[model samples]
Target: MLKWLRRSEPKEVPAATLGPLQIVKPWARSSASEPDVGGGYMTVVNDGESDRLVSASCSAAGSVEIHAIRVKGPALEMRKQDAGLVIPPANQQILKPRGYHLLMRDLASPLLAGSKVPVTLVFEKAGSVTVDFAVEEPGAVGHVTLRSS
Candidate 1:
């Protein structure tokens, strides 16, 4: 009797550390009814002593703004945060749906699911790191996965 041994498949982990910056779980998707207004969520961990997200830009939309969602008397409101998002040392900030997020308005074209959209996140210390956001369905949560890089 001969026995055969099986080998485990290797998992392809994403490359860690893109330049001086480390991006954690960046995700973006379009909203229902209004496809032009896309939403982006992500976390950035600044390994360096000092750094913060100054601004963000994307070719997928005409304008991108950092916003926060609030509920006032049963009304859902989204407002722009002029102070820019901050990433503290050894800390993380979460950008999620119906919360703090990157509001992509006036999309140049339609963004479909499974498609990748290029976005550039500018940091005050680490500079700019460009990454592709995997698009998903509207109101879809927890689809965005980010590793160090």
Candidate 2:
């Protein structure tokens, strides 16, 4: 029956959720140098009441801020979202490249591939939810399915 030839299904990484807010496929880009800046990406799904992603923190970085890109006179600049990002009820907020993402500044150490970064996300309604973000290779895009190492 060629049982050994059967391909295995890719295992999906676990998502963290508190109440109606679920953090899916959280990931961060790998850094090659110390004190580097990085971006954190993820999708926040709200199944019940609306919530606001107020802030985030991690041991890997000194500061984390929610940022959005805007065009200004033939140039692109990153602006901090002072009011934070909103996730409406029954909706989702996707944090990706060139859009909304977590700006990690003053990195304590290089974030190498295959490592995981534990981040605590504070929401207005959902409270604080800590999730481990899988570190991917440099310039990695889209959701990544992690394999157990």
Candidate 3:
């Protein structure tokens, strides 16, 4: 005997559609003097659902952590985001200067301008995404020396 057709059927999500996260305008500030620390900026957009950015890693640098700036009295201060960065559904997380950004400490070498810095971002839902950050001038702002065009 053959089975009858069902009234409704469940659908399975595709693997390609699982990765609905995107990274835009990834950039890192260049250090001319081979400083002990470096910084990077980017925008993480989640078009599907909520996710948590657990951690980050870079082979070129010693350590990687999420950082944010806070104004304390008459001065501004920078600190690590111990809880990690979270990405809400249909929302975007920004990583910029004087805000929620990334900290690259104990650099192996100076981040030269017009170069690329490869970093891997680990997400709880989306897994890991490896993106390259364009190196900009030491004191420059915006996406001036973007090489990942």
Please report the candidate that would top lDDT against the real structure: 2
- Residue-wise C-alpha lDDT for candidate 3, range 1-149, written one tens digit per residue: 99998787653322122388788788897444345567888887778889988889998889998877765565556667777888889987888876788878888877888999899888888999788888887762322121211
Predicted structure 2: lDDT? 0.80
Kindly report which residue pairs in candidate 2 clash with one another. Answer: none
TM-score of each candidate? 0.76, 0.78, 0.76
Off by over 4 Å in 3: 1-18, 31-34, 140-149
Off by over 4 Å in 1: 1-20, 140-149
Flag clash pairs in model 3.
Answer: none
Task: Give lDDT: candidate 2, residue 105.
Answer: 84
Candidate 1's displacement at residue 118, Å, is: 0.5
Report residue 23 deviation for candidate 3 (angstroms). 0.3
As for candidate 1, its clashing pairs are 25-146
Error of 2 at 101 (Å): 0.4
- Of 2 and 3, the candidate ranking higher by TM-score: 2
lDDT of 1 by residue, 1-149 (tens): 99998988973333235544566667788877576788988766555565667788997688888887765554557778777777776665778886788989899876788888888888776777787877887763333322221
Clash count (model 3, backbone only) = 0
